[model samples]
Target: MAQSSSGTDGERRLDLIAMGRAGVDLYGEQVGGRLEDMGSFAKYIGGSPTNTAVGASRLGLDVGLLTRVGGDHFGRFIREELEREGVDTAGVRTDPDRLTALAILGIRDPDSFPLVFYRENCADMALCVDDIDPALIARTGALLVSGTHLSRPGVFQASMKAAELMKRQGGRVVFDIDYRPVLWGLAAKENGEDRFVASAAVTESLQRILPLCDLVVGTEEEIHILGGLSDTVSALRAIRERTAALLVCKRGANGCVAIPGAVPDDLDDAVVERGFPVEVFNVLGAGDAFMAGFLRGWLRDEPLEQCCAFANACGAIVVSRHGCAPAMASWEELQLFLDRQDWPHRLRESVELEHVHWATNRHRDYPELTVLAVDHRSQFDDLLAELGAGTPEQVAHFKRLALDAVHQVAAGDPRFGVLLDGRFGARALEAAADLPYWIGRPIEVPGSRPIRFEGAPDVETSLREWPLNHVVKCLVFYHPDDDQEMKARQDRQLLRLFDACRATRHEFLLEIIASKHGPVDSTTVARVIDHIYSLGIYPDWWKLEPADDAPTWDAVQAAILRYDPLCRGIVLLGLSAPREELLAAISAAAPFGLVRGFAVGRTIFHEVAAGWLTGVIDDAGAVAALAENLRVLSDAWRTARDARQAA
Candidate 1:
């Protein structure tokens, strides 16, 4: 529903909606170069709205949190945490039949933290308008909500109703567009062998939520994904007129600018406010904090730029600590940090920026472009599990999503290539039909002999009958473990396999210990080195792996480089080796650009592999903990891969 032009307006008393599920942040995954054998995590209440409430309250504002929590202890704990931070939690609803949301927070290193949420069919999704306290919203200043809650019908309906109410009351509605693809329904192919995602459902759901918000805040990349706008100004302008609200576009470190309206012409016509700078520690809550601060500024009648600064400062402070809500700060604390900065100021004649010229300038002309979304073999399983599709349909649907993802990424660049790997779900044949490049194995079909992927020479060949390329990411764990007997067999095959693949000169990903056939002798190392040097095309990248016998990073490097010098990356395998240690090896090997990465399935899947992957009755109804472990492995790979490219 559109906000009524006819209404009573006053100082904003924000009715912030924590529409998304709330949960506790748990720590897992590889950290500090060692695998953590422990499970206990420092508990903290975290969620987008929860953090926003704390950040806003810290900034001193009137904010109320609305959402559902279970009647369980975790739910009660969540409410208490909100109240402790001064957030008005009386509006929160309780569901007797459900459980509170919990987030599995993990660190692959300092930066690559991925979250696996347990909120499917949970209490948070049960939030409906019946749970809403209309009086609370009626007296509020603004409505702040996140897009995550849009995944479900009841919560979605409730959020929509609240937005309508806020609009009718002339209160501003702010949306922090955080779309977690994992949360938006995907499912696996039931045969326990394959998985895929439905593209139409994902797209249709995204389109449903874009029009309701007034001031939208999200990263440039997120905007590109949601709106398909590659150009900065044009994308903001494109989404402008679609909704009557101001379009606030974030350019990351460059700060954010708000368009008066969402229209192409608004780029040149709107009031643009530049942000004050702050040394950012954590960007997690900055956008939401910014929204809270913007409302805070609006309530206090402060200038727009000051609001952006407050938001950025709030974000900067949060990032400097751990979790979402670090601690709320007073105005003096924020201003003290701001005043310490020595920035150039303008009086009468500083720069030519502030002066407005009536001259109509030509906007940068961008070529007509196609956007393709690449589906890495990594996402195959998760997409499958989430979309809930059967084998045949999963293959077909996954094929399209994969093709679309690739096309989106390669749109502007001519050299862009889609790579399909058989190392993923049991069905790569569907994907292989389209992609031209591959790492290993021909895409295989189910319940029969595998078929060759139709593209160029790739992993869709022999020996790919395994998940080596998928489970063993080149950055984290390059390959799985094999006995000395298997090692001897591999070394003998390495030369012949190298020659056969060398015709295409395909570079196979190898773990030195796993590939070494005969012995740890230098002659054996030299022989293998000679073969690797022969067909030298880097297949994206080749990673070094620590030997099962020798877990140290130096030993792994010395073992590989004693034979070949180009070992830039390493995979930390071996069941006993700690993830933290492996990370340290990555750090130590930085001199060789060796700080690159590893593929660690066992390190991640050890829970399942060790028979420790089981959960109580709660996890019993869903997929096995091992399935989750595998998903975690896949998620970790995506995080690691993204981190590498981002660097």
Candidate 2:
């Protein structure tokens, strides 16, 4: 079997191979405004072939792009962007002689976006047949070539060669009548305005390639250009006469139509016009996104109706957001959008939709977190006694005030996270769900009662009931010298918890504490971690006390990586240590990449809690005090982390 060098197991087996234009799009960021007055712009990977490749990849497809990029910063940017999205760039050639193409797009309104293409002697247009790798084409399930690239002789030959190779190797050909007339040198103005003009030469070139394609996709305007007919029905008939490929007509807002083989005698019988009505922002990349969705369903052998639905959803999502490639939705995001069922209207304001968008767009890897651990049960009792207020209502009020302090500290900072519990922090946890900060819910009860989880009877049920955004933090107190039977029981319990976490898809943070029964040393911690891994228990994050030294932290990190390289890294536990000491420990750990951040508890707000209970400070004073301490710790951690990264 033919294979691409970049493919896994040395087999080509690509879901889609795209050969055409690849460029950077500089989109104006000013919404509800004109292009001239736009103050800012965002850069995104653009072009029909590139957008399709990225969109399909986002939907979990193995895709590759075959194009040329100038050996410049923009070219590097394009390559990196594609690589980040899991698009195979092995076929992306770099030309030292030319510059990468760029598109300056301005959003004047939803219906009108001004665009100027800077592709005169651009690297992508210089694509040659020599750059075509026949083996790679053969490995792909489908080879996609855009109409713009087909307009030029050099790129046209490359696209033709790729299609021919793919057909000979039993791969399907997908032709996107992308129809960019500005590239044909027919639409030029002194002010760099974009215009489209239908010409016989353009139609002839497209028709020559149409018969070789197994599928042809285009918008109504694109079809008019290809078929040389103004009427939609006439255009479909003309296109059917030239190619036996499946035809897909993309009608913005009104949905799309997909016809198998030639145009049916009754065109209405073949058309599928289901689509989500979305508030259009910029319609530039919606077609490419639509193609991506259709291809995802088509390649998966889904029903034509379902494929059109996916296409429409994808197009709706892109049109509602900014940029092209970056605005494409992942499968999870798309599913959430579909589940809301509030389409053809303003659904962007829905919190559920926003949550899905944020979660899906967040980085897959663990982010740098400054977690504040305030899951104190006994500490609250001590404060209540000091204040002489034991009523349930008063206790709840105090807890609410403390949680408000934490919220105040975390407000405006996305890096901040908090660890709360169901006992005293239940209300806080509920509130945290609506906030942007990460929330860690503790599973283990406080104190050293042989490391029992709080609410043991409902541990599994509670974990299952927890929100998907929350992390489950399990603190286990174990000693190497403990009674063997007791140790075995604890191990069993931990294994059960780990399995439960895995089953529920909750990220686990294992907080290991070496009891007085064993030497509280780094070696002991490392042994415990190794033993846990041996039992097939790997956690996403490690919550540990400050290591005795830098070497101790290094040893712990080494063991963690050895067991699970993908571990989310360690966070230093406060253990009620003095503020100065905790800060020092954090500074030491901050130098290591394996140390993510700290989760300090009492050190931050213990004094404030005491003061508030004794009437030495008001509620506002307490909140202010906690915020100050949090800010100090957050700044210290950032400084240390930034310095280490710089070094």
Highest lDDT against the true fold, candidate: 2
lDDT by residue (tens digit), candidate 2, 40-69? 676778888999998888887889999999
Error of 1 at 415 (Å): 70
Query: What is the Cα-based lDDT of residue 534 in candidate 1?
Result: 46
lDDT of 1 at 535: 39
Candidate 1 overall Cα lDDT vs. reference? 0.49
Off by over 4 Å in 2: 1-12, 189-195, 363-647
Best by TM-score: 2
Candidate 2 at 352: error in angstroms? 2.7
True lDDT of residue 489, candidate 2 = 86
Worst 10 residues of 2 by lDDT: 1-10
